[model samples]
Target: MGAPAAAPFPWREVMEFGLGRLGWPPDVFWTASPHEIIAASEAFRTAPAGEAPARGVLDALMRDHPDDSGEAAEA
Candidate 1:
């Protein structure tokens, strides 16, 4: 038999994983949507060592456009 298929990452789990690395609380990270998680992850990945975006911008975009697919959000 071939190997079993890998499970997809759950939205909350992925968000928590990304946020945990940044020292955020579970409750805060879990409340974010998948798009938010993706955007946050990308931002962290692209940011310079001391140049992360403001939390307010991340929080606002996440709250205002929770349903965004992350394409428009990135632009």
Candidate 2:
């Protein structure tokens, strides 16, 4: 008999929680690796107090990958 396939990772919940904790929009989470999420979250925490939200990294990911928006290409 063939071995069972592994369950998919809980990407949605993990991403949502990570982005929420960092105070960044969750839109970038789907494309972010766990390491990236961790790094961004850590940076947010370690940033200077009263500084503007550090969303540049996460926001830039979306800006750079415009085609990954899940929209179908026009014929």
Name the best candidate (by TM-score): 1
lDDT of 2 by residue, 1-75 (tens): 999999998777666667666556656766777798778767767888786545886567656665756764442
Question: How well does each candidate superpose onto the true structure, as a TM-score?
Answer: 0.43, 0.35
Clashing pairs in 1: none
How high a TM-score does candidate 2 get? 0.35
Q: Model 1, range 10-73, lDDT digits (tens) per residue?
A: 8566755666675668776667777977788788788787766699987787777877675455
Report the error of model 1 at residue 53, Å: 12
Extract clashing residue pairs from model 2. none
Which regions of candidate 1 deviate over 4 angstroms?
1-6, 10-16, 50-75
Per-candidate Cα lDDT values, in order, are 0.72, 0.69
